[model samples]
Target: MKSRHVIFPSLMIIFGALSLYFISQFAEPRFQDASVDAKFFS
Candidate 1:
């Protein structure tokens, strides 16, 4: 196998995980608010 093939996939996986982590962090507050609204409205 070539090094480019391995490096690209490795970088992609690392970036994917980081993006997911940041997304979850950013989304957590919205999710909390949604849940609170659900509780109050229901």
Candidate 2:
């Protein structure tokens, strides 16, 4: 039971890191339009 607590949080942290990495890759700029383009936050 104690091990379950540690494992769950570790898995969540790993998944979050992976998600951010992919988002950054997909948000790369590909156009001159400052108002419309792939962005991490827009």
Candidate 3:
């Protein structure tokens, strides 16, 4: 029962970190523009 206190927060922190890392990596495009040509040329 006591372990649950530590384990739950640990899992939450790990999950949050992984989620943030992945979001940062894949969420933002290198090219801010939406059009293909603009992005390709810019």
**Better model by lDDT, 1 or 2?**
1
Instruction: Assess the local accuracy of residue 42 in candidate 3 as a C-alpha lDDT between 0 and 100.
Output: 55
Candidate 3: where is the Cα deviation over 4 Å? 34-42
Which residue runs of candidate 1 sit more than 4 Å off their true CA positions? 34-42
Residues 1-42, candidate 1, lDDT per residue (tens digit)? 699999999999999999999977787677677887546644
Ranking by lDDT: 1, 3, 2
Winner on TM-score (1 vs 3): 1
Which sections of candidate 2 miss by over 4 Å?
Answer: 30-34, 37-42
**Best-fitting candidate, scored by TM-score:** 2
Residue 6 alpha-carbon offset, candidate 3, angstroms = 0.4
What's the true lDDT of residue 6 in model 3? 98
Report clashes for each candidate as comma-separated counts. Answer: 0, 0, 0
lDDT of 2 at 29: 51
Model 3 alpha-carbon miss at residue 10, Å? 0.3
Worst 10 residues of 2 by lDDT: 31-40
Put down candidate 3 lDDT per residue, 1-42, tens digits, no spaces: 999999999999999999999967764564454567446655
RMSD, candidate 1, Å: 5.5
Query: What is candidate 3's CA lDDT for residue 9?
Result: 100
Return model 3's CA RMSD, one decimal. Answer: 6.7
